[model samples]
Target: MFQIGRIIMPSPLLRRLLAALVLVTLALPSAAAADCYVHYKAKRTNPYGLHYGIIRVSGGCPSSPGGLVQSRISSGGWTILNVVKVTTSSPSSSERRSAGSHYYR
Candidate 1:
């Protein structure tokens, strides 16, 4: 109902809040997120043990090189997970993305 319906995220905080509001809509199992879905077969050579992930955006993800979702694996400590953005159909102009190293900076 989020992506297909009207979602009003007026500001960044509101957007985060709106996104948070929909978290309960998913029927996630604790063990399920441990296995994230990899859409691009070309990238996933060994698709055996991908760790957990949370769906931040609904429409697959933003179209950065990897796709529109981000994920991480946890051991004794959390591992560095890569975020991806993608589309099933041909992407539009807004879908293209460039990764920046200075995201946190």
Candidate 2:
């Protein structure tokens, strides 16, 4: 039998496999925990104003970025032009503030 931390395994082979599984499981979260940011363009009616902004995606998934962008932006009556790009990096705080309240929330 072999012991790893608090977990015990009955055989050496089982211990190695268990250790591998544990390592993989532990690594999954950091991979999944990555945050994605979407930079986009949008427009509002009436006076017809246009703006560019960046938003942090919650789920960090493929569909989540576009959905989040549309839901957040359109709720304020802005029509989405396009999602320029999705990235794991965020702009500086000052840059976000420059986009104003209507941008990233």
Give the best candidate by lDDT.
2
Give lDDT tens digits, candidate 1, residues 62-94: 446243332322222333355442333333333
Clashing pairs in 2: none
What lDDT does the true structure give each of the candidates? 0.35, 0.77
Evaluated against the true structure, the overall lDDT of model 1 is 0.35
Where is model 2 more than 4 Å wrong at Cα? 1-21, 92-98
RMSD of each: 18.0, 5.0
Which lDDT tens digits does candidate 2 get at residues 1-105? Answer: 877898875897887999999999999988787877788788999778998888876546466466778888777788878878787777767757766765455
TM-score of 2: 0.65
Candidate 2 lDDT score relative to the true structure:
0.77
